[model samples]
Target: MKGVLVLENGSRFSGELIGCVRKGYGEVVFHTGMTGYQEILTDPSYAEQIVVMTYPLIGNYGINGDDFEAKRPWLTGFVTGETCDFPSHFRQEQTLDQYLSEQGIVGLTGVNTRSLVKMIREEGSLKGYILPANLLADGEKFDFPALPRDLVRRVSTKQTYQHSVQGESHVVLVDFGAKENIAGALTRLGCRVTVVPADTEFEQIARLQPDGIMLSNGPGDPADCADLLPLIKRLATAYPLFGICLGHQLLAMSFGATTEKMRFGHRGSNHPVQDLRSGKVWITSQNHSYSVRREGFPAELVVTHKHVNDDSIEGVAHSVLPAFSVQFHPEACPGPQDAEALFHRFLALMNERKGSQLVTTI
Candidate 1:
């Protein structure tokens, strides 16, 4: 079977089909990681997006049971220059073709990925469609619609649920298309996690009596989620809060900061970020297309981390509230673990608050 990727700008790239032969459409974005295809494929943050893998060879190690970042794949489609049909790994259970087919994801291979990535870098992310090559016409016009703003609601847990019940500190995780690793990291730190929907009410969360609030990474433009800013601001004042990726942008905007779209955005595992306070650098895993802007900055929030490449803001902390946020994935499901210590810091804040509350009640 053959397929073609048609971008909204009328750019078309032809390739052979490797997985489920069907049409897929959504925003077209790219990832720069050399490996970790499994985790990227299953990440909820890629929902409503067709992912172009910049790495030439994908699925060389194939798919394994342990590496999925979510229960299922959320990306609209997958593309690559080469798809490895035969993989060699001790833990490998299936080939890339088999995994994509099983997950019902459109897989197109043998395309000029470098040229495609260059177009994306120059023109920015574009909406696209993966269709059978036979569907092409002599002249085709493609118009891309705005992606739905309810992506968080579509991907979040419809009902609140507990990931685990055995831990000292209680954390209510606001699911803005959260990855499984976020909860896993907290559970490993002895925190009982209660996963809640993005639209969950503040009164409902207060009933849970959480020690801290964890705003999860999500997809799309941060401005589209402006409705949540007030809730985030309230949460910060009430509990120790840590935000990641989309959550990071939302947290900053709640404090009068703004966000802007990047040219192509960071979607790699090797992004470098420096802690401004410590003057220490760490390699981080990142997957977002929007970032907190630096112009007309808010004074109450301090810049705690910065991107080593373009000097973009990577993290921020409220001046008085026990709240902070980072634009990278410290859980490191598909990247380095250098920033994993941030989780420890969050737990420490929760513990400190608990001690203060105990003293006040006495």
Candidate 2:
């Protein structure tokens, strides 16, 4: 069936409907990753966004159950230049079309994705809709509601859960729609992970007596989560705290720093980030729409990593507090694994704090 993608700016592209036939709408954004469609589809960070894959061909690897980042796909819609109906990977359980259909997501195939990407790059992110070609010709107006501010709440866990129970260090993950691979990564490092809701109070967290705290990646504006700022501030003061993506933005805001929406935000796996301490650049996986603003940044926080492309803040560490954050995914499911060592750095921070407490008690 024919489908048409209409941007808020009045631009339109007609293509074949490859997934569900229903219309979908959201802020239209593009990702440059050549692979990991499954992970990107399931990542909650893409909530309320219609994702356009810049890669000319998608779904070549097929969908596998093991690679899902979240329990369900959260993007408002999917767009691709071309989609493979038949996949060739051995672990493939089903085609991407089938997966998106099952998840009630609309997808457009054979689209001029390169052109859409270029437009987004030049005009910034846009709110758009994907509907059947018939709807476009029917003269019926199509308008989507404004994206909600409660995106994090819509995606975050409602209850706390545990993972990697047998691991040594106990870490509480404030799950603002966390990817499962993050817990998997910590588990691999012998850390017991307890995931809590986005609005989990500091008192509840304190009762867990966790050795470390993790602020997880999620969807939407960091300012929308103002209710959690006090909790983050309290936790950062008392524990070894680490954050990623949205969590990084929240952490910065907790310290009186501010965050701003990016112009066509970074959403690729091949971004280069320079580690300020080591003076080395590492390829990173990133997916976020907002970033920490440099003006009036907190004095206690020190820049640790920066994006090589725009010199944006990619990582920061508190001068005296055992807290740090990064805007990129170190757990890289479908990207280069070079940044995995950062998890080890987190582990080292936890261990050092533990040793100091042990000495103080003795």
Clashing pairs in 1: none
Question: Model 1, clash count?
Answer: 0
Candidate 1 lDDT by residue in tens digits, 1-362: 88899998988999998788998899899999999889899998999899999999998998899988888888989999998888999999999999989999998999999999999999999999998887776455567888777677778888999998989999999999898989999999999999999989899999999999999998778887889899999999999999999999999999999999998899998888999999998888999988899997799999999999999999999999999999999998444566888899999999999999999999
* lDDT at residue 358 of model 2 (Cα atoms): 96
The Cα error of candidate 2 at residue 234, in Å, is: 0.4
Q: Against the unseen true structure, what C-alpha lDDT does each candidate score?
A: 0.91, 0.91
Error of 1 at 343 (Å): 0.6
Where does model 2 exceed 4 Å of error?
A: 333-335
Instruction: For candidate 1, report its TM-score.
Output: 0.96
Name the runs in model 1 displaced over 4 angstroms. 137-141, 333-336
In candidate 2, how many Å is residue 98 off?
Answer: 0.5
| Model 2 alpha-carbon miss at residue 157, Å | 0.8
Error (Å) of candidate 2 at residue 56 is 0.7
